[model samples]
Structures are given as C-alpha cells and as structure tokens.
Target: MEPPSTCPPDLDGPTIDIVVADPGWHRLIPNAGTIVRRAAHAAGMEGTIVLSSNRVVRGLNGRHRGKNKPTNVLTYEHPAPEIILALGVVRAEAAAQGRRPAHHLAHLVVHGALHLNGEDHDHPGDARRMEMAESRILHRIGVPNPWKRA
Candidate 1:
C-alpha cells in the first residue's frame, strides 16, 4: 500500500471504532482507521466501520439490499450504526475513476456516515443535497468533491 495518506488532526466529535475485518485492506489503503475516523467525524457520525472483503460484502448486500453483488459501501442503523466497505470493490472503483484509493475510501466512508445520519439520495433533490453535504465534509477533511467533474 502507498504510505499512509495525511489527514487533518483529530477534533472533538463522536467517538468511532474501525474494524479491519480483512487484512487485504492494508494493501489498498494505508492508515485506513485515520481516514475512517476523520470522514465519520466530519459527517457527524459515531459507529463501527468494517473494512471487509468482497465476498462478505456481497453476502451482506444480497441479504440487505437484495443485490447479490459487492458494493463499495453499505451502512446499517439497526442495533447500532455500522458501515461496511468492500476493499476490492473500493479499489477497483478508485482505479476506474482515476482517483487515489484513499480519497475514494474516504468518500465512501463519508457517504455511509451520511446515510446513517438520515441523508438519502433516493431522489434527485435529495441526491443534490446529499452530494453537497458530502463535498462540504470531504473538502473540510482535504478530499476533493467526488461529484465534481475533472
């Protein structure tokens, strides 16, 4: 993995726990815990962030989202707030979008955090608002807006 990416210093916010369920995550993004904490804090969320494999994520997706495919990220609110990310899917998407894997991972973490906080992109208006919030949060944490075209 590339050297751990730099992130702003931690600030006062909700406490978050990061669980690296898959060792492969280290090969995709170094210092992932820092990224997840910063992004989750910026999104004003507190929860467990699970860095998992594609197979595990696919099973969760199929059971929860009704799609038998590995998604970049997924968030759950029941029992406790939790966000799951698939390393392979995240890395591939980052490569496809020509973005640094760390940046994409941060974006998805923030996205999942927003979802847990009641930000939904199911409709166009909602999507715009959610994207704007994401851009704001990402910018605060030094990541470029994912919605902005290069």
Candidate 2:
C-alpha cells in the first residue's frame, strides 16, 4: 500500500512520499522519514520512499534485478520515481561502518535520489561525479562524506 501522504509543503522542493512498511524502523532510527525527506529534497528529487524489511527487499531484488539478496536501497524511475530501503541491511551496514544509522540512511536516500535523477556509477568518471554530488547533497544536510569514512 502507498503511504499516508507525501512530505509537507515546508520542505520547498520536490514532493517525496514516505511509506513505513515496517514499523520497527522507528526503533532503529526514530526520524527515518524526516531524514529521507530531507535527503530527497536536498537531491531535488520527488519520489516514494518505502521503509521495509530485508524479506520484502529481497523479493523485489530477486524479481527485478535477478539478485536474491537484500540490498540497502533500490531506485526505480520508470513509471515514476521510487526508492526502497531495507531496514535490516541499512542498520547492519551502519553498525559495521561505525556510523550512525541516521547518517547512513540520509546518505542512501541521497544516493538513490541521484539515481532517480539520472545519475549512475557504472564507470569510473560517472562514479566520481555521482559521489561528488552525493557528498555535496549530504553535506548540505549536515551528513559527513560517506566515502571519507575511516
């Protein structure tokens, strides 16, 4: 099902819809929607963000990407812009990297939003360009550069 509604007008950017399929996401990061919305706005993207579990994400990944693993974030820009994030994978990645879940979530949203905005990292040059864009967007929201993580 879709979310209750998209982000409010105060953000002053693209419209971002947020769906919290897994309520437990709050336990991992209470302001997941806010973080996502802010990141999406920073990237100047309008889309839907689904906060779901590894099980849900794995199913989608298998059907869509032919991969049978739970990924952190997936972006679809065909019919419309949409981003899905798996709570389990995101939390684990954050812990493994010694970073806050909130920061990681923001970074992922920006990354996915960039994808929706036609950014790809398939080549070295493209990767650098996308990384730089992600860094700038994240910095605007006060998130550190994920690439510079120790």
State the displacement of the C-alpha of residue 84, model 2, in Å, after optimal TM-score superposition.
0.2
**Candidate 2 residue-wise lDDT at 29:** 87
Tell me each candidate's TM-score. 0.90, 0.91
In model 1, pairs of residues that clash are: none
Model 2 spans with C-alpha error above 4 angstroms: 1-11
- Give the per-residue lDDT of model 1 (tens digit) for 11-126: 66776778788877776777887888888888888878888889999999999889999999989999999999999999999999999999999999999998998999999999
Q: Candidate 1: lDDT of 10?
A: 47
Q: After superposition, how far is residue 119 of candidate 2 from its true place, in Å?
A: 0.8
State each model's CA lDDT, in order. 0.87, 0.88
CA deviation > 4 Å runs, candidate 1: 1-12
TM-score of 2: 0.91
lDDT score for candidate 1 against the true structure:
0.87
Candidate 2's error at 123, in angstroms?
Answer: 1.3
